[model samples]
Target chain A: MKDVYFMERDPYAPIRHCYGISKILYEGKSKYQEIQVVESHYFGKILILDGVVQFTEKNEFFYHEMLTHPVMFAHKNPQNVLIIGGGDGGILREVLKHKSVKKAVLVDIDKDVVEVSKKFFPTVACSMDDPRAIILNEDGFKYIQDYKNEFDVIIVDSTDPVGFAHVLTTEEFFKYVFEALKEDGIYVGQSESLHYHLDIVVRFQKALKKSFPIVDLYTTVIPVYAGYWWSFSVGSKVYNPREISREVDVETRFYSDEIHKNAFLPPNFYQKILNGNFKY
Target chain B: MKDVYFMERDPYAPIRHCYGISKILYEGKSKYQEIQVVESHYFGKILILDGVVQFTEKNEFFYHEMLTHPVMFAHKNPQNVLIIGGGDGGILREVLKHKSVKKAVLVDIDKDVVEVSKKFFPTVACSMDDPRAIILNEDGFKYIQDYKNEFDVIIVDSTDPVGFAHVLTTEEFFKYVFEALKEDGIYVGQSESLHYHLDIVVRFQKALKKSFPIVDLYTTVIPVYAGYWWSFSVGSKVYNPREISREVDVETRFYSDEIHKNAFLPPNFYQKILNGNFKY
Candidate 1:
């Protein structure tokens, strides 16, 4: 007998991926979305929300390190950091690596995701007990409206632009994010894939450009993701992401000084993407 | 009713990908391998050989450009080029763009794959009619043993190290390739993915290092391939592939001057990979 678990990336398209499920660890419905945790033969512990893969223990470091470190290292002195929609605590783990970070606050809409992650993904959720860490069980969209120039670095580690997370990609929401960040604060988020989600990246870049002084895009390959060339969008008020201002002293599997310099897309290719002339 | 075509990347591991096939253009078995062409809703026309996807019309440029141009431009003057196992003519098309090239030779074991590509993939196979092109239906292993110091550049565009193509990755075969090249000649081939096929890459690099003076590795992202981050192994005699020696005069969708510099993996990461310490 063979066991297979398939996840459809898009309902309208005929593309799907499957993983050999060794065991089903947890399954339930949160107030916001469906949650699932499973053990796989290849990727180890896997987390799924609303039928989309969030992270796997095998390669979550690529996504978490690329998402958090680029923007964190780009800033000069990041003390107060705000993370939106990362209940899995992977982002929190990477943020706490910086010694200069005095406070790290995470606001997530789903409390069940945190509980499930703490139970199944203990390594990723280990940093939640740190004294400098703060967890808020509230909607990120509603929580950011109250913050005004309170953070040195704001990282939005949200899901795809669908369901309850849809508003997180809009221009109005970015305006609130811009206002919530300090005058010299930096912001970064998971923008989506350059293969299948170029439109979303372009829309988010346009919205971010309207509120920030400098905006750029970088990419890293995540094997289990639907589109392998995962992208991230960065917006800065006074710093340039191309130059790393701080020393990387943390122990990492993928992030490095040379990778930080080479991760950004080429200027010509980025211009084509911005002009909507990118072939694929 | 729904139409679906699934391709399992590995038999031992439970990982598979599928595409919604709107139409099947051709399906037949040759003396070498099984060939199929299908019209996909998202990827347009896709070519599959022996249940593995070779390329798709939507993103073939990423693979072809990355495979052909890095070595082509790295050399001072590539007047004569030989491509082994590229029956689809995509690599041939990119090679013909340089006016300095006087002859382009392509050899493949499967004649049926060439016929199917010319008929179903006309755009990619367009350069077959060029006066400078030569096509041979013969096995690459036996054909290269007779040549010595013949070509300026030799590209082994063969499939994965399986079935009839398995001999192409052996040390004795690379010895023949080293003898078949000029004093400063360059050699490059499609190495497997870094995510799943790292062992094959490590083995191939070890084999190539015995014959060539300088061996390097680079990567590109192909969305439809089983592993998105595809690797390429290059062996050079004199020139360093990290620097471009000539100007790129061809029109391309993905390859650029800046991309040539950024496409290679960072030295630190490559060292980790060579040391067998890469976690992901």
Candidate 2:
């Protein structure tokens, strides 16, 4: 009974520390689930279940900085960008910072995630309602299949590759992404961890390499993820997102030109794989 | 008692479910703690602690690749080098890969770490007993203070700069590191994480920038550390590590000429801090 109560209270929290959830506020919405700031005195909480960062409080910049700057700055010119699965609207907010960006389309499976994020995580999930922002609630992979080769940069800001998002990392999905981009387009998406999912990352990297000219793997520290350090496979053609330049002036809090280049720097394992030693 | 058992079963582990521990199989007497891959079904147990990796199942090129290739290839002909706290000898193995090395010195507070590593984790810690290597058990900070204007490269492979190792990142310590290096020496050290320990990283970056002319922060995926995405800070006196030659033919598994340049690239928070935005 206690465990069940704990799960209901903080289902997504670290198992040992679930008892510490302290509700700040909870407000209901018609379309979206709800907006709340359920604080965990021990570990921070940001209820993004339906794709929203609903309870973000302490370190929003950590996630925003990591997911945004690396992919955006890696390209020489990220004028037209597409965000897949980031219904929370955080990616769109970051995309608007680049002066070179002329348009950004956010395609998420659920519209509720965007609505919830806009209402709760205002600091990061802002700009969801921007006029240039086109919100399409549908399967991101399917959307990309029909979406022409219009985007220079594609940021796949999906959740854990489990449940509905699991198919996002498949070879078929990546092939579609490859077809959806311009010649020099770059694809950046979450690829999980170095500890539990090295094989998963290896498969994704190998698959992306098969499809793209350059496949670079980089990681960032996210408290909620399985290993906290999450990997990202950047599939590129002709242009490395890191090499691209945007003399564009944009006010950014976490990502910069320097960080942009470092984001593509692969960890030790990938470096070995590139050189043909996969034993790690 | 069960909780304590779990904690001890995975003492250094910060997370559960995705965490596992492998026994050292050997301990004590040399510089610091040393271990072997007695267990570990997930990350494959080829453990690398204190810069010494044990190759129980296969060669651990990933550890050496992530640590050395990035830095060495980035530098222009690094002849003289200093290693702070890498007593376990894995770094020594990585450094010895470059034929350009004229001299190498490794300093650790505890010589036991070096000794145990020398005995058990040999393949990854190959150069621990090298005659060309100058191994010292004295404090690295004190060693740096004594050698003013001595080395071309300095690698700080110390434990996290908290608790006992906290002084390593202080302004005084960085000043000593700056003084110990030649006019063009480059310094790199583990800077913790961007997820949980951004404050510490930012502080270290601030201190390094003040101590050295150019500073860059980068990361690698090490599952044991917080966020799995561990941070690294590079400090240079007169030259950028990026200017180093890309053709260092070290028999490495991870770092390549391209990876060296990529290592110097910063992610978003790295750029933000370097550009003077430390809020996030």
On TM-score, the leading prediction is 1
- Candidate closest to the true structure, highest lDDT: 1
What TM-score would every model get versus the actual structure? 0.97, 0.69
Measured with C-alpha atoms, the lDDT of residue B114 in candidate 1 is 92
- CA lDDT of B183 in candidate 1? 93
Q: Write the per-residue lDDT of candidate 2 for residues A164-187, one digit (tens) a residue.
A: 777888888888888889987889
For model 1, how does the per-residue alpha-carbon lDDT over A187-242 read when each residue is reduced to its tens digit? 99998888888888899999999999999999998887777788899999999998
Q: Which parts of model 1 have CA positions greater than 4 angstroms off?
A: A11-14, B1-3, B9-14
DockQ class, candidate 1: medium
